[model samples]
Target: MNMSTMNSACPGPFVRRHNPCGHRTGQWAQILATTTAQDQEHFLVIYHDSDTELLPAEAPEQHYEFGPAPAYWTE
Candidate 1:
């Protein structure tokens, strides 16, 4: 795929650097700024030494309650 383009989808030159750690099926994400919206996707720098965290796109506003559902965050 060609990088450094004028678009909104693939912001900037996004590249994933795979760091091998004596195993497979693990990877990280990194981002390098550039003059393009596609560049934002490259902000997540993945490293082997660092632990990557994945969160939901957006947190649920109203959590359904089921018989005193587990409470947290001052629920």
Candidate 2:
């Protein structure tokens, strides 16, 4: 996906990204502010369009791999 940033007359730079699943789907979001909720730091991003939605962000410590797969001839 391609991301673009606008340098308009705003406090923070406006960021926009296109949805990879849809050709004409895209969204623009800006970092409105930052605050701590329940002792966890969070960023407040406002979306200008409804083409996309936001999910709860998480910080994963490390990546784990699934074990080796078994080989089977027939299904």
CA lDDT, every prediction?
Answer: 0.26, 0.32
lDDT of 1 by residue, 4-67 (tens): 3424213222233233322322232223232224332222222344543221111112211112
User: Taking the tens digit of each residue's C-alpha lDDT, what string does model 2 give over 1-75?
Assistant: 101221231224333333344232233455454445665543344554433333122221111111122132110
The TM-score leader among the candidates is 2
Ten contiguous residues minimizing lDDT sum, candidate 2: 60-69
How displaced is residue 17 in candidate 2, in Å? 9.1
Q: TM-score for all predictions?
A: 0.19, 0.34
Candidate 1 residues lying further than 4 Å off, grouped into runs, are 6-25, 33-45, 48-75
Q: What does each candidate score in C-alpha RMSD? A: 14.4, 16.3
Candidate 2 clash pair list: none
